[model samples]
Target: MPVTDVITDPENLTLTIHADFAAPVERVWAAYSDPRQLERFWGPPGWPATFTAFDHTVGGLAQYRLTGPRGEKSSGRWEFTRIEAPTLFEVLDSFVDDAGQPMEGFPAMRMTLEFSPTAEGTRMVGTSHFDSAEALEQVVAMGVIEGTKMAMSQLDTVLQDLRAYAQGKGTRLELLDDTHVRITRLVEGPRELVWRAHNEPELIRQWMLGPDGWEMTECVAAVAVGDTYRNSWAPVGDTPGQAFGFEGEALIIDAPRRAVTTERMQGTDGPTTLNDLNLYEEDGATLVTVLIEYPDLATRDMILATGMVDGMEASFRRLEAAVLV
Candidate 1:
């Protein structure tokens, strides 16, 4: 367990948490700054957070939602007020709705996170300042202490590993639920190059070809919301496969950071899937995460059974060898 102490003061209207990790301060700070690593332990065991918007600069805002075991979601936002790199950062945290507006009846709190070097490793100290004693009591009554303990307990695994998680794993798949699946891959390239490889027609054609014997016949780039993108692939020469294609409309586009789209097979009226792609860079590599939401369990299973991961792995390898190189 990472948490060493928890103190609640009704008089001061503060709740403080102290956690120790057996890792360097920089490593621990990376676990918090990187959204992918943050997602691994930002919520309790049953609820996992998905950060849709994260800006780590002063005056920036982050929006995230925690999804329960039964698909229930609670949204929240953080407005960053102070940032001092790997040592200290502070934010105004508040509960928000799906539209990112603060919800009524829930009080906002100022949260300060501080990290310091320790004899053993790193010490993480967090304090939440509430407006009134009643406001502090309200969150405590909502089981915030217990939930935070459970959430921070999972961070040990994230910090202990030297090899960054999923760095060598070509393409990883995690079934989030019956209709939701997440795919992650560490691309050996910078974020801007990876983002461009997915958007530019020429770059996409060079790496997105699934296998050795296929070629991208058509590629239509989508750069804005509501814009449509279509891609087709055909087996070249005597390669044994029929031509197929996919088409989608961009729903949200955030340049080199994230994109959300609705995708479906070409020439078919079947149900569409929501694909959310996020990119985060550290050191010199970028982590690409795609969360796909299918229509039902049957569709999810059918798609996975189609050797999609293997194809994605092949494409990722080609991306490094051909485009990123």
Candidate 2:
């Protein structure tokens, strides 16, 4: 986690956060000024931010929304007030409606973010100035401190190149909590091709096979919301494994960008898992992120103990070798 200290001063009507990163000042500044990188860690876990508009000039504005796990949304805006390249910037932040209008009862805050070179790397200081003590206390009580900590912790991942950070790591899993786990893989391919490899049956059959000696017997991909998808696999001759499949309905689809689905094992009445898949492309490589919501800790452990990650890693390697190349 990059955040080292958080201070809330009611008398000063301010909340300040201090963070240290092992990245240079220019790199740290770029992460905040670039909308694509900013959205990667702008919101806390389970709630991801999407920036609709980003204008980084002194008088420009940025608009974004944080989408919750269940499709709920909270919109906000930032009016840039000052900029000093890789050193400092300031913005007027406020809650906004979907139409880009400021919310009625919410007050805006002036946020100043400063970056400085340190011996190790870069040090950041973020201060939010509120209109009154009441406003400062209001946001603090709403879990701003904890949310900011979680959000900033994700910056380390963004500060490094996706391929450098995740390629050799294969399919990695991070248990976000009792019910949520984040899985990631980096593939050397365009985002469009990666999306096609997942949705097109021909491409899927070429790479979705988990391990050697296994064949994908059936693949019915879901292309839109409410569409159902099923995929089955069987071991090849002399291979020792049982035949099984998974069935799911797509809950959301933003072709070549993101997809969310509910997955359950075929012929089972057990709890289902919500799989949210997101693909991001930088240069020619795509980072595939899947945020899964399990029912409970027991279910999460049981699924992971089934050698699921190993199978996923094998399939991803094949994806690059067979489908991507």
Candidate 3:
């Protein structure tokens, strides 16, 4: 295997490392807080890691189950000791058995991370202290220092993602329902095919609709921050529900992931009523969560009374067919 990211000093118990990355202090700080961002970047060159939990608070702990080079799954934990945002953090680190029971032979160590703000980005320093020189030697031999270095590099990639988000280049959650009903469906084809169907305007009309014969006549979408859009749904083959063409604001348009929000119609003729829209991916499938915080229990009752899930499911099935093609 290639050497771990650590530079070794063959005789000491104090292992120190200083590396500089090109990123801002705030962005670097965000990488520490966001676990999805962490998993995207932190691991060895070939050994990708998956995080189980990461709550970055002064007393919180971060845990990970990493698949090692030889396909062995190794677990580690970091208990945060101190945190001073955008500046420094310290934690107690340890390796453990499969169930997080402290291993009989594993040693606990203190790991401190210090951050220095710089023009290019931030300079990071890591210090690890073992209980004894022999314990330290065993850690080095077992590749702890290398793992630390690899983790740091992964951290760097995380900082880059934070920068992208700050620059408005990302898939961001606009709003989430305090209470929501998620509609999940397996598209007939690949996930990408399903996703594409949801995004195409032409296909959106096939599935998305109003009550009786209410058709989508016109629509325009702005898929990004600070972008507003509208859609017009007109009554067609008139049957039961015909609430004059609904149209409102695209308050949040995170199109990178095909999410949007519309300020739904009010009363039966007023301006808006509903709140937001969110889309998420799951294990080989996708979810659509519509967050509609009502003005009162009455409005909540109003939306739920409309059999919206039924309409939405119908739309989704059409979307499935369109995209699968």
Best of the two (2, 3) by lDDT: 2
Arranged by TM-score with the best first, the candidates are 2, 1, 3
The C-alpha TM-scores of every prediction are 0.66, 0.94, 0.48
* lDDT tens per residue, model 2, 6-110: 998888889999999999999999999999898889998767789999999989999999877567788999999999998999999999998999998787899
**Which numbered prediction scores highest in TM-score against the true structure?**
2
Better of 1 and 2 by TM-score: 2
2 versus 3: better TM-score goes to: 2
The local distance difference test score of model 3 is 0.58
Count of clashes, each model:
0, 0, 4
Residue-level error in angstroms, candidate 2, position 98 = 0.9
In the range 1-325, model 3's lDDT, one tens digit per residue, is: 1112354454666787787778777777676667765654456533445678787888888887665323457777888999988788898888877787557787788888777887877777778877887777888788766665655654543454323322322112222233332233333444455545555667666666633466777666555544555667766564655444444544443343334345555334553454444333444444443445445555655666777656665666566554556
All candidates' lDDT scores? 0.87, 0.91, 0.58
Clashing pairs in 1: none
lDDT of 2 at 218: 96
**lDDT for model 2, on a 0 to 1 scale?**
0.91
The Cα error of candidate 3 at residue 94, in Å, is 0.5
Of candidates 3 and 1, the better by TM-score = 1
